[model samples]
Target chain A: MQYENPKIPEGINVTKVHPLKTFAILVSGLLVMLLVGAWLLGFGGGYLASKIPYSQEQRIADSYEGDAGLEQTELLRYLQALADKLSQQMNLEDGMDITIHYVDEGVDNAFATIGGHIFLYRGLLEKLPHENALAMLVAHEIAHVKHRDPIVSIGRGAAISVGMKLLLGDASPSLLGNAGLLTQMRFGRDMETKADQAGLVAVNTIYGGVTGALALFEILDGIEDNGLVKSPEFLSTHPASENRLDELREIANRNGWSMDNTPVPFPEFFNRSLLLR
Target chain B: MIFQILLILVLLILGYFVGSHLEKKHYQSIIKREEMLRDIPAVASKILPPGSENFNQVLVMGNVTISVDYFKRFLAALHNFFGGRVTSYESLLDRARREAILRMKEEAAVLKATLVLNIKYETASIYKGGGKAIGSVEVLAYGTAMIPKASIDAV
Candidate 1:
């Protein structure tokens, strides 16, 4: 009997598919799966979150409220007064209240958080050319509050986290880790455009026109062009083809809201107070 | 966050270059040594030949441990999510088994064995707590070497 160790022909046990080709296919497939999953789950999460009682959400928001004892300074009071006016124009539901907080930072950003808390940075506030633009800014955040976008985003974020944890087998399942789920305020593009249109409505109601309001988008666009604002991650912002200014004008035209009127200047000392410190 | 992304990119590039180079070199060496040592026949048979009384049986074994690179590990993790054949580990196991067999044949050659019989393989995967930890495998090849009694006496 003959006994020999023949070289087992190559490619029998191993796959011939190139490793890089496999990598590309697998990576692209994963990305597409994740995007689709996020979209479907985001809407599902937002729907379930919307069903939650507004009072329960407010309580949840209050539990995480350690805003370092925000002082009721003149600027804060003025901003809050403006937010109140915007809230009235926006016709938020009863028991829903808007609160404005002035962040003494140079970042050109503004955002709304849970429990109707809107943070306005000095850098952004100082850049506004007129009262209508400032109102537009304030109203945009208040519109987010009115739409309960903060809670929707929180719900979406939590749903995505739960999905990931199920996949990853999270070792630690602590309650506190999810206690403050409102840490992120990433609203979807639809929410943002809805808020923009609602904010324009408020500005149109308050000033009888949207003369200075479009400047807000102009200033924001300029800041974006300068790459000053690093947008939050995982936010699928609107596509570039839908220019906000043009869209806003279209909304204004559709609603018959005047697009031009004498712009209202900022209150005396508003600039000085913004420039202070 | 940017720093973390940059770190992962750097690790992937390093893993690809180093891992590919090492695998190529290891296969080349294994091929060269396999040809040189093929003269000592190894088989998976339990029975001896017709004139079997003149030989001494010696137990010979060879084992190898191979680690996975970051690139392959990441690929395998992706495969785990998608539920498909984990092709990334195919080359690894293949290399390990062949290398182990070559080492066993080399041992048989050292004993001037005419043939090795009843060869078998034992395989193990080394895992550490499962959270993004690098993976490794160990393969052991063992057989009985049939060395002529005359050669044993000469030794």
Candidate 2:
């Protein structure tokens, strides 16, 4: 038996390869590369794109040059004077004229364009539960103008804009269909945050503190429970809502601004507009 | 009474459609391509070959501006709706940009330069209304209207 077993050569051992481990390593490496690539692309694109200069002052001056289609109606004149007064108090650059138009539709949206063009959506106008809130929104948008946020936004959006145009063409509704909605989702959230901060500063300079800003946020928060498509627009654009509110409170505290201690002239604006209507 | 309520609803719906239609019509008339292009400077006319200007550097400015009243603004707020084609706004911006470029081109022409370098742009928001919707979007587009500096003499 010994002799028979004799020449049993020592068995050569082969370790079994674990397929899962190999796959995990490969997948992990791939994920790491993807993260690195995305970071590189986003920041790299931003830097390179920013270097392609775009001017803000020139655009504003040009915008004001054309026919500003509003007749000097009493209302128009009043609004213009009010805006000018505010601008002067705020020390906005000279040669910038503020224009106002009245729309009958309903929606809450306000925006500022280059060259001192401000649009107040009918819906937004109607929702001014308080005048200060309205002032806040206006101040915020104005701040954006002051800080040249629009120009910067345009620049930041340029890359995405090109890609979007290539993919979705002009933001035309018919061409947009469902796809355009998806494209809208692709906007950078960070830009909105920057606008919020800048807008706060602008409003603070004008209104004395973050009260107006907070009021706007409060209004937005109150409306969030409402089921509307655009209700989330502000929130979605400006993220970390709680944090922003806290920051606003801090800003108010530092600036000696009141948070709900006194009477703001809401009725005056409301009653005045009512009489005009 | 039921019939009356239904009738009121129908009228409201109809009014909405009619109002939207009227708005669209107003925008169409106000944002005429011809008028917008007219804003372009003569300098642009000289440098931009007829067709080239149409596709590029052609600007349009709107003839009308509207503001969403406070009540309307509240409605917009519920929907968070802010802007539209604002075709008029777009046209105005487009024209302004073209005009600026034209001016720059004219300057270049005087300098006998073909290319205008170092283009820049800017925008500002003017607020109106006690507390309501936006009035208009004033857009400005400015870019260096380039031609070789030597080409300036040809003009």
Best by DockQ: 1
Lowest-sum lDDT 10-residue window in model 1 chain A: A233-242
Give per-residue CA lDDT, model 2, range A98-132, as digits (tens).
Answer: 55555444655566655456666656666666555
For model 1, the stretches where C-alpha displacement exceeds 4 angstroms are A1-8, A26-41, A61-82, A102-107, A162-183, A225-242, A267-277, B1-12, B53-84, B122-155
Give the alpha carbon lDDT tens digit for every residue of B21-62 in model 1.
999999999989988987788889899987778988999999
Docking class of 1: medium
Q: Candidate 1 at residue A21, lDDT? A: 85
What are the clashing pairs of model 1? Answer: none
lDDT of 2 by residue, B29-128 (tens): 4345324333223332234443332231222221212333332222333233333222223333443443444444445444443333334544444566
Per-model TM-score, in order, reads: 0.77, 0.43
TM-score of model number 1: 0.77
- lDDT tens per residue, model 1, A1-277: 3776687676698988888888899999998988899778878988898888888888877754557247777877888888888898889999898877788899888888777878788899889999999999989888888888888888887787777677657724642253445345677778888989899988999999987888888887787778856554344464232288889988888888887698888888789888886
TM-score of chain B in each prediction? 0.94, 0.33
